[model samples]
Target: MKMLAAVVVLFLAAGLSDSVILTKCGLKQQLQTSLTLPPNTTNVLAQIVCHVQLTSNFNTSAIKTINETEKPHESQGPRRGRSAKNVRPTKVTPKPHLESGEDKNEFWTLYGLFQLSDHVVCNSTQRHSLNLCGLTCNKLLDNDISDDLACVQVLINKMTAVIPDPETAKHIHKMISLIYQPECANAKASVYFADCPQP
Candidate 1:
């Protein structure tokens, strides 16, 4: 009985230290991700959960809305064909296209970008999380002013052959820069509820 109590106390301590402000969906997502762990480990880890609050202006509803409505451009490029004169089957398979359809939801896309930014911030030359986000946003800027949709669209476009023009990239860069600027204090917000794992 004493040993069980100690384990409970330890778990409570860990949970308290890593406490975060997460939405209902965010907590659900984390539980789902945790379930993926091996059964043996899952049992041991199930008693403890950690949440970190990050700076982000996004919400679950916004993510869901965008993902369900947006679609990536389809590839209209020509396909390779083997003529009778060259009758061998082509060994090379075409590259997998990045599909942007109604299914491309914002939750996963934002999640992935934040996850990547986190990794880059921790492991790469970019030591600051805001800098890492800026680096990505800079590439998407198209004009003097930037909008959230423009940045998101550029990111989506990057998955395919359609590259954003310089003007567009500038606009996005400016927008992202504004968000990350010190006055806005929004850079950290990007990290908010960023790692919620869902079923």
Candidate 2:
């Protein structure tokens, strides 16, 4: 009985060892240092902090599986011969089965503190990934978040480019304002980290 108890304790310790629950202040400091924003960008850092807090709650080992089904294109109509009653759903092969032993069809997975997607941003054992970040998905789950921040910068740059107005494109805070409710705008970035210990 004692031997079994020792094994259980060790197993729990090993699982906990890989994950780091970061303090809000720690996360803020890391973001300030790691992310490269444009000159005079305001509240963008806080917006990121709010986003991360909502997404993963500062847990380094956070992961979420999204079951995404392929949507039919707007231009494509229903099949010519198949009626609604005759149509059947086809099962697609699961992509990128993780080494961690989850056998379900994980269409897309959000990983780590920032919840970066394995489908386009990071590579995994799963096939048919765009791998825009050119790094492994496992890297995002570790305590070191510099790589994750670098990828975020890439995504931000891409997003800003899509905006027609040059002034709005210069800052991501404007983008956040458009997406989130007015009450939850960049002004509330500090609110997300209010619980953190102050210096």
Candidate 3:
């Protein structure tokens, strides 16, 4: 009974602490390569469930979309002739493709970035009590900026092959820079972003 109470208290405390502000879906879309998942919810729930998901909308779609987006493998057939040319079938070669590996789980990576930035803002002990938030943004000038750059590189390499749009791509890139840039005293990164409604 005591343990259960402890866990519940921890849950609410964490939730309130990690309160969300802005969620950059466009930025995630950029890093995630605009691999659209099934449209399934309202803006309210988006923060709670955003990075919380394990599977990616991309990988799920890949099984279906790959054929259309990717080039078909060359068909192999048995060579016909006599002894020397003895009819062995050639193996088909699949086209080389980009793999997101874990990056496909856009939310997980973003959440991780947020968690790291949170360290810079709140004391290490306070890190435990954080809520499920959407923004999961970073607001450090130098350090978070470095992380954002790394994330951008990951997404550019992973998602570009899928999205293939320059303008949307640029928009996402810009947002990533915005996410990591520092704000005032920095009580929490999300608070600053969530304060004003997203334009």
Candidate 4:
């Protein structure tokens, strides 16, 4: 019984450690400075930072969703026996927009698909690589057409070694295929805007 308990505890510890590593690797801000430079300019560090940024964004969004769901809203005061109408709704500031609808829709579609791809890619790997490519590829799909093709090529190399689980790989493959869909490819010919594209 004691041996069994020890084994279970060790398994739990290992799982906990992976969770910590995943959390540490997933924050977008953590990798921002490092990923800004071209991948070739910084060598392995840039590639690693890029991969970490993609994965970190996935984890950040997932955690944010969970936190938001569990968070108690002050607006729900009536549920807590206070007068609900007395509580003010939280005001959200809007972000600036500069792109036209077609371009915005295309960029957003790529953004959402990349987020989904990161989750699938990360799930299949036994160990995470710092060279994950989803977000970098998304840049190519967006209106900003000046991103270095070499950068995309380098990021692509990062995921090559990963042997993804068959099921998730199918989904990842599908999302990737959408990137080159005729409409999306045609739309990319025009540079939609010159400013930095928002993530």
The number of the candidate with the highest TM-score is 2
Over 1-199, each residue of candidate 3 has an lDDT whose tens digit, in order, gives 9999999999997765533232344334333343333344223123311221211121111111112211111122322332211222232333343355833421111223222222112222323312112123333112223343353344334333454666545434433332332211122324322433454
Scanning candidate 3 in windows of ten residues, the lowest lDDT window is 57-66
The per-model lDDT (C-alpha) reads: 0.28, 0.61, 0.29, 0.31
By lDDT: ranked, best first: 2, 4, 3, 1
Measured on C-alpha atoms, candidate 1 has an lDDT of 0.28
Number of the top lDDT candidate: 2
In Å, residue 132's CA in model 3 sits off its true spot by 19
Clashes of 2: 1
**TM-score of model 1 relative to the true fold?**
0.22
Native-vs-model 3 lDDT? 0.29
Q: Each model's number of backbone clashes?
A: 28, 1, 6, 1
Off by over 4 Å in 4: 1-113, 124-155, 158-171, 194-199
For model 4, residues 1-199, the per-residue Cα lDDT tens digits are 9999999999998755422222222322334432444444333332332332332222222111111112112112223432221233232222233355633321111222122232322222322322234333334333232232233333444345364577545444543342232212222211211122444
RMSD of each: 20.8, 12.5, 20.5, 17.7
Give residue 107's lDDT in candidate 2 (0 to 100). 56
Q: Give per-model TM-scores.
A: 0.22, 0.60, 0.17, 0.22
Instruction: Give lDDT: candidate 3, residue 143.
Output: 26
**Candidate 4: lDDT of 125?**
39
Mark the 10 consecutive residues where model 2 has the least summed lDDT: 69-78
